[model samples]
Target: MIRLGYPVVGVADLTVAAAFWTAALDLAESPEWARDSWRTLVRQTDGERVLGLMLSDSAPEQYPRIHLDLLVDTTAEQETEVERLIGLGAQRVDWDSYPPDPDFVVLADPDGNVFCVVDLSRAPSGS
Candidate 1:
């Protein structure tokens, strides 16, 4: 059976992206594969990698079809996490696609990669 691997994010400045992501996710750099243009971020709990950052000059998609969702159990947690991410250089995205009573907040990383902070507790049934 095939298993899902880490999501690889394209970034303009690998060093800055690496620093921001590591702090945001509480992950650590994988020293074994660390480089100027690429870095792997590992989860601190089990030392398993969560994602890979690759250097790229291309601009981030204005409306990416694929984006990461950081899940939190409650709306309070989601709000707190959003604030923390903003403090870590992430910017809140003024998204226009939200439904009524939305349970997620859109945000962008330092490189303008879009993602969401989702509150699972507020999700509709069977979602």
Candidate 2:
């Protein structure tokens, strides 16, 4: 009855976050980019529903218990991606929820919304 969709990460400045993600994921903003308050709303090449980088003026409390799962090929590669993300605008976080031998690294976006980069491992080597 319900279909999952791309996730949104709210931010204080859409343009800043959009710039970061455009570099991190090598994606470009949609032609429909609002150029205003919704400037951060972006679409991937696949035409997935726009992922929002909403302004902080929206609300408090992290919504929906959602975090974007960015898939990489290996944990070592994931580590490198984490470093790259840090260079982009991410901060490392202590995600106790994940396992010891994690296939991903948990981190927060520019606005502090958390997400994880997961390695596309054949076996569930880690949480």
**TM-score, every prediction:** 0.93, 0.76
Q: What's the C-alpha lDDT at position 127 in model 2? A: 64
The residue-level lDDT of candidate 1 at 118 comes to: 93
> Tens digit of lDDT per residue, candidate 1, span 38-88?
899999999998999999999999889888999999998998999999999
Regions more than 4 Å wrong, model 1:
none
Clashing pairs in 2: none
Which residue pairs in candidate 1 have backbone atoms (N, alpha carbon, C) closer than 3 angstroms, thus clashing? Answer: none
Each model's backbone clash number: 0, 0
User: What lDDT would candidate 2 get against the real structure?
Assistant: 0.72
State the lDDT at 13 in candidate 2.
79
Best by TM-score: 1
lDDT of each: 0.92, 0.72
lDDT of 2 at 43: 45
